[model samples]
Target: MNETHAIAGVPMRWVGPLRMSGNVASTETEVPLATYESPLWPSVRRGAKLSMMVENGISATLVDDRMTRSVLVKADDAHNAYLAALDVAAQLEELRAIVRKCSRFTELVALRHEITANLLFLRFEFTTGDASGHNMATLAADALLTHILQSVPGITYGSISGNYCTDKKATAINGILGRGKNVVTELLLPRDVVHRYLHTSAAAIAELNVNKNLIGTLLAGGIRSANAHYANMLLAFYLATGQDAANIVEGSQGVTVAEDRDGDLYFSCTLPNLIVGSVGNGKGLDFVEENLTRLGCRAEREPGENARRLAVIAAATVLCGELSLLAAQTNPGELMRAHVHLERKSTSTTVGGW
Candidate 1:
């Protein structure tokens, strides 16, 4: 028997010397091509990145700065991409500020505290987090609003509040307060060369939206509402790092976008209900566990728990998917070309099939 000490980089101390039945020890060849099999495959990894976006709402914009710093910047790559120009932390704080300012979400709907705001209706937030940031932001908004209401009596806080969550899908409001009626969503996409696939997919959705009233069916016309394209959510992230594929059910959100002036389209997605905590689940798995550690998201003293960092990661993922669909709809040839390019770049000996 050949002695082994580690599984997927999860090292286990070797207890004994190697023992082989054969007279001569077998020779093993180092396959450099196996590097392609690493969790960070160009395509699969990119998919993993987008899951972050699908899992979280953007600052209405913000990029995965950590990702850009690690993969592209560190490697000295020429170009890079991001959503909102502001740092993700700034965006998070901005949202926090919005909540802080509002003493209440609406009339007779006072918060646990009070605060203020400028944009009467800036964004219809998705509260992208574990369970719509229901408990998380609730605790926060409660404290902030409560403080302001008790202290700043002069502030004009409404009585109604907005936030939502649901153990099951029912009662359309999602159990959230301030569940506004004019909740418009866009399948956000980028106008750059690297992120234009969204046009094709967006077109497909648009066609459905345009004819929905007349034809009463979705894109391919299966069952309009059940048009689930969440396969990418699980496989992509699972193969990349340590995450429970099941959580994706609660964490995957699909939204649509329109209103492009230059004939270039944009798309955005939000999850708003992914309650993923780093320590509890997916702590053990061969390659999965190792992959998380390798990504440096997981580290000693709870380094993996950067909600902001995770949010940024999620935004990047949303951007990718939104762009992919849009591009596919606008020019399918681009996707074909991307596929061809990825295939060519892959190591033939290891990938084995065409």
Candidate 2:
């Protein structure tokens, strides 16, 4: 472990006994239908391995002892968290454009509403680097959005009620999930739910479980996209880091789903409310300061619209990472081959240009 390692475990190599476990908490308490898939894990492992090499190489350059090698690690939770963050980050530009239009209409109606909250509340997809991009995108959006609100027809009615430098609110629109983030595969138990769960806690509600006999029989089982896992993990990371967790309701989404060879589950996560800031009262919150440091996020990244950029970065992180995972499992040794191929292709393309 390096001096910068924040996660409890040192080396992220090997899950030891990678068997499917019971389940993560779900607010929907209906018939518990389980989903299945096997696309995300291998790619995530591949990325983590690459990061490990980087960290180890950096450490080895400084010290001669093999035992002294170390690097910041990406665990299973962190893996999912980072991927979801990336997906959310990529949607920043689209969200910005949409919010600008939405605010004009919502505010012009003269109703006692603020686009501030709604504008900041968003959904997008991207991938994360080795670490969770929760703080990264939140800070990115917080910085980027102020300009959007300021440039518009006076964003007098959005959720960003507070301000840092710009007139935008100190509280950003909350967010969840990233692109290509991986998670367990499973079907929602209820099988049919049209009502939008405004609150993030709705997933844990028993009525959504669908596993209660008659309803349970109607429940469907299959695989989900890693996006769902990324969405939930990002939410969990946000909650742990003192972010506005409620945004998960508005900004969260599960992007893709499909069945595995075993026909179990497939799912993905999508979220919009990536409300976060680089500097805030929460900086003093327990362990949040430390967590930020672990993720390598810094204050410079927090500014007008900076949050949006970081959000995009988070999504990109997940995208690249999930691709990495998918490549590894479907073809064993493919990960190594890809790295080599990418290098060779880059070289060939560069020489061809000359």
Candidate 3:
């Protein structure tokens, strides 16, 4: 079959010379976002502008980094399943050796398993250098599966992925155990800065966060997520940087925290599953390459440094947008007015029959 491909264009913009400092990266740089939501550019810019007003700006920390894949096997019986899990767990060094053969960058860092009714689910976690490690983790898992089936008695292959890895879906396991780069970004805005740039008081944004993000999400049965439109910023950043856009599924599963610290605003966004890489499947694209370079993610560094830098930037961007949106919601007409003005080219419209 002959196949033709076409380019789908997304409006791209550089939103900030955002000030960031952390263990991974300490640089003030403009980040690129490709999106159809024109309002996002200004909203995020507002947040970035606030970041600069603070003394330390945004402090992003890389808490953990790993990629995961799970493989399923069937045992002769429930007893056999338990035994097989024990046997595989004992072979950690051997499994690590097999992973090394798959790729120099792939290292088997940890293993976990669950057994039910003669079925075994083996979760393999890896440290993949400078890549998101989706394919790399799968390759390592495949090799380990082959070795396990041969050595461990009473077990046969079932399938490669058993959903325990929980790729591209909002699952509680991903948030609890984590997948990809885990980053926590924080900013402390003075009461005056909050009032000046956000046009909202610290107490107001903090109250809205509890009512809307925390309580509202809980009542709605959201799984391990509480935030306003984290997916929006993540999708835009992922697309601009040539990341696997679909990773935004698990990527958006993050939490936002706000506090009125004696009249100052203490805001944070914790992204436990930010799956991004500076070099990967989409990195070959000219635009993606350029964006990564401009974001300072393509520089030669230690084995996982580039990806870590990208993850922190992505988290900071999330915090910026999250902060801005929460602040806007503190006012009755601000959000709708801005949307109408930016998206519809008009600012005069009744909001909720006002």
Candidate 4:
């Protein structure tokens, strides 16, 4: 285990295990949600003060966008691309069945192809249940590739992973096509609540988003993302919940948008690559299991439901932390002061200007 330092005083709050339902690929399971404690809960609490329900929707796609490995096959002739493509299309049912034989929880979602010179890359997307499904997807891909070589005509085997899957890396395709649990969490903060709790107007938060997140990102040449410190929340949540910490690479590639709706603040965080599961290697560990149980995610449910619930809660936690940090940074000295007091070893009240 890497060094685990307790970043104390990061106030945690339980917002929802609220009734959330939608077209999620995984079985629908609602897990009680909690977030890493933060000192900015007062602002977060104000936003949550109003009677509001957080609605979460999940869409399951079978491409282990995090660990998807593609097969690059070179056809003897360039014209064979059409034949190979047609043959692949024809064998869709067989491929699906092949995946079933290989793994119980995985389903073949779609087969995609790309052609370059004489090489053809066959990309498969599958709905891997509960777990992140990285190894499951790769294993299924190998079985299908073996069949393609023996039956398909005029083609030679290529590398197993063609880099098209873009696993564990930041790329444009992950956002455009999507990767893990595509989670969107949204809330509308009442005008009075905004001022009472967040101590800032909706207009101020919206303006900060534009100047800091949107325009500032463009000025700094950031590609395909606009946010201040999503990684901060994601890393903390991942560690607490026993997620693959490395997956944060693509997981952090997301956008936060705030709009002033008349007098209220409409805030949303869209995470295209949130790869979390309730049942996995690290989840069985003592502390991790206890954490999952605390969040109400440890209950036995259908195969994929637990994982889906975990993903939704994770997205919500991220929204809470993101909103708090953004609000704190809006003030001049609050951000540095909070870090110095909550994160620093020395009990110094002042750091540079804190």
Scored by TM-score, the top model is 3
Alpha carbon lDDT of residue 344, candidate 3? Answer: 84
Residue 177 in candidate 3 has what lDDT? 92
The number of the candidate with the highest lDDT is 3
lDDT of 1: 0.32
TM-score of every candidate: 0.39, 0.29, 0.97, 0.81
Better of 2 and 3 by lDDT: 3
Per-residue accuracy of model 4 over 107-215 as CA lDDT, tens digit each: 8888888888788888888778788888888899999999999989999888888878768888887777777777877666778866765667889889899899999
Q: What pairs collide in candidate 3?
A: none
lDDT tens readout by residue for model 3, 1-354 = 989888799999998878989888888888899999988888888888778887678999999999999999998889999999999999999999999999989999999999999999999999999999999999999899999989999999999999999899999999999999999999999998888778888899889999999999999999999999899999999999988899999999999999999989999999999999888798998999999998888897998999999999999999999998999899988898888877885554222121
Which 10 successive residues of model 3 have the least lDDT summed? 345-354
Runs of candidate 3 exceeding 4 Å displacement: 345-354
Model 2 TM-score on a 0 to 1 scale: 0.29
Candidate 4, residue 315: the lDDT equals 70
Better of 1 and 2 by lDDT: 1
The parts of candidate 1 lying over 4 Å away from their true place are 1-228, 294-296, 299-308, 332-354
Q: Report backbone clashes per prediction.
A: 60, 111, 0, 12
Error of 1 at 29 (Å): 31
lDDT score, candidate 2, position 319: 28
lDDT per residue as tens, model 2, 65-132: 00000011121343443443344355555544543353221111000111121232222222222222
